[model samples]
Target: MSIFKDFLLKFRESFKGTKPVIHSVLGNVFSMRVIGNKTHGDLAEIALTEYINEFVEDYSAVHTGKEKFRAKKFEEDISVTNKLTGATFPISIKTYGVGPLQLSTNKDGSMFSHLTEIVSKSEITNSQKIKDILKNPCFFNFSKVNVLPLIYDEKNKTFKIILFDLEKAYNSVSKVTYFPPRKYGKDRETFPIYKFFTADEQYIFEVRYGGAGANALQRGMWTHTENASPFFNEILNGTYQINEPLIKLVSKILVSPREKHEKILDLLRQLNGNS
Candidate 1:
């Protein structure tokens, strides 16, 4: 098994102490398969708010249900407050497939215009430009933004809830590139996408300029969970794994390639030995 598979398997031992109510909430979440993605996302927000209150220690969660007032005032779906310290955390909840996940939406063209201006005026490196833009208060408020992504991996038929450390990610960024709308595809002439990278040139995320006119509502920042996963190993230890069928064990053994199969066996041995 690759490092990623090993990491996931270790965390897959089933989360303990989960509230029973959460199981029912998750059931409702899965039942929304026929619903639109937007409705699905709304349900995920409610589920996540409840999940945080149940599992996370020292935090009280409040659901900021789709109110236009809160949307304009806050950038997060859930507001978490530390019970002891009274510190507050603004969390954005996203429900997405294993593909690219949007980190934040750019309803207006301000983010795009700001970035373009920086690129034109600043002689700094792409990373510096990103850091600079983030520092601007005119951009997305709250420097310490936290993302709670509920990712559904279609291939594994599993759901994973993990934290995308946007704060740490900002520092890790080493490059940022702009991709204007392609001549082909649905995005053609609709919007532009900005790709972010780490020091090693690993892709971190993208700022998608949602299309023009009615489509403009689609704008947001995005990232692939596969690419963003490694940046947050410590957070991964607390991942909530769900939807895996019992048959996965036998199916994996039968379908995995020989090399990967052997690696899985080796990892199992190591786990057993440690136990």
Candidate 2:
């Protein structure tokens, strides 16, 4: 018999020789289990297939030659723009799996040296050739590049450049690694590092973090708020008066001298007390 068939026979025999009816009952249970496993596997495959198809279709639509905006690549930066809004933004995307490398470390420096050696060995020697070599999307060094946020002004048609500060952002992220496997020396040989390295990892960097990190969130939020801000400003612009009868009454209760704007101070005090 084939090795697979022999293995199945051994698995089947493990539940046998109890009683005649018991063996039959256990065989039925085993059959049901196998069928259920196959059904679940098939369903998962179908669902994955559907998701891939939908994603490909959506991607093609967004990236079609006639699409309004497309990703632009400069010497070392990438800028994504909205063709209709005249808004342009620069974004730096980086990976986290590769741990931070210190500038002074020999091992880190050697890695770059190794890369330089490989590039030098290549036939092309011109600046354009060097640019083409660096353009390979796979080779990303986390220690070298940091993600920076770019803001766009719809009114002025200009991009705002901001520095990235990632100080407290890493603290907020849950350090959970999915599908943890038992640690074994041989396991390293089987692990697919390339596949895992390609997967996109999400991190949260809030507004208060400051620098490049803060810029990242600020740029994204500003891009979203640009259209809504004018409408909101119009509705709320004339609602308050400098010296209104009703405003003076509320201002006395909540406004303090240290605060610059009385109207804003009262609102803040109310929110602070409520929270």
- Candidate with best lDDT: 1
Model 1 residue runs over 4 Å out of place are: 1-27, 52-59, 68-71, 83-88, 120-130, 138-142, 185-190, 210-217, 233-275
Instruction: List, residue by residue over 134-244, the lDDT tens digit for candidate 2.
Output: 333312332233233222232332322223322222222222122222366855422110000001233222111112322322111111123212111110000111223
Model 2 C-alpha RMSD vs. true structure (Å) is: 29.8
Question: Lowest-scoring 10 consecutive residues by lDDT in candidate 2?
Answer: 190-199
Deviation (Å) of 145 in candidate 2: 0.4
Candidate 1, 21-69: lDDT as tens digits: 4444554565454444566678777776766665555556788766742
Question: What TM-score quantifies how close candidate 1 is to the native fold?
Answer: 0.65
For all candidates in order, the CA lDDT equals 0.61, 0.27
